[model samples]
Target: MAQQDRAVQTRERIVTGAATAFYRVGYADASIATIAETAGVTKGALYFHFSSKEEIARAVIDEQHRRVFESAAEILQATASPAETMMLMCADLAEWLVSDVVVRAGIRLTTGGAIFDPPTRAPYDDWLATFEDLVGRAVAAGELRQGTDPARLAHFIIPSFTGVQLLSDVLTNMDDLKVRVGELWDVLLAAFAEPTRLDELLALRFRIFGPAS
Candidate 1:
């Protein structure tokens, strides 16, 4: 168990280090030698775990999706209300986008061309499909309004996160990010929540998303 744990930690360290290195420097510019060095392991050690740079990149992205999907599932399982569940999902995604180094790297990779690959897109497609199914469940539960399309809701929410990711790459100010995200959530809540629930949702915006100020 100890050796297994160590191996897992080492692999994770390599993934995280490679992700940060790739994000800071373009993947085209990053080399396995450098990644190994950044990860504090020898090139042979890296090779023992991952045969090539492409494999490492894919592993990093896969781990990122694993974390995101796991978090989403946990959030969904914890809540019975669809509205609250979706809001929490968005919040969790946004929080990771804003904070996690690995996820930020994955976002960059997605926009940079890695997502065009079949293996790269597979996990993402599965995750999105599952999330959409959750939205469908919400609709069936009557937590969402009539005619609410699960795929459409997933489409809208996913793009919002990616849009923020693109903006984060260019916009250096975190304060502006908070305001922009708050406004975006306001628009989303307005569109999805019942009219009678708007005021409560307005309060929920601050509660879930935090203060924009």
Candidate 2:
């Protein structure tokens, strides 16, 4: 049992170290030696855990998704309002982007054209499905404007966020990611919230995330 636990720990360290290396130098430039040094593990141990850099990149992406999906699920359970759930969910994601190296590396590895296969699909499709479900629920609950199409809203929102984060990464290196996300919420509320529910959504946003700036 102890040996198994240690192995788990080692693998975790390697993933985290790989994330740091990937984030700093990107996937292509990050060599096995760099990853091993960053991870504080020997080459043999790294090779034991992962046969190749590509496999390690996939593991990092998987870990990143697991973290994000878990947090989103928690927020969804805590919030009764679908709109509120979606809002807090996104805020949590922005926070992850700012604070978590694994997430940042995963975003770069998956979106930066490092991996060119199936796992390369951004956290995007998953979020789109989730957003669409919540939007549908919000429309049903009268949280959004009448006649709003959930699929349309979901598609627009995901891309809008993608653009916001991409630009934030390019310009500020995401120094202002949370701020950009907050601003994005403002625009979303203006466009999506029902007239009668707009003020409520705005208030909820303030309570949950403080303020855009």
Candidate 1 stretches greater than 4 Å from native = 1-4, 114-116, 140-143, 173-178, 211-213
Model 2: per-residue Cα lDDT at residue 191: 84
Regions more than 4 Å wrong, model 2: none
lDDT of each: 0.75, 0.88
The best candidate by TM-score is: 2
lDDT of 2 by residue, 100-125 (tens): 99988887776765356655665778
Backbone clashes counted, model 1: 0
lDDT of 1 by residue, 1-213 (tens): 799898898899899989988977878888998898888988877888998888888887787778887998899789447666776776776677678888867767766664346535665576568668867876676555568888988877666756775785677633355556777777776677656667776787788777764
lDDT for 67 in candidate 2 is 95
Candidate 1 lands at a TM-score of 0.85
Question: Considering summed lDDT, which 10 consecutive residues are worst modelled in model 2?
Answer: 113-122
Models 1 onward score TM values of 0.85, 0.93
- The alpha-carbon lDDT assigned to residue 178 of candidate 1 equals 58
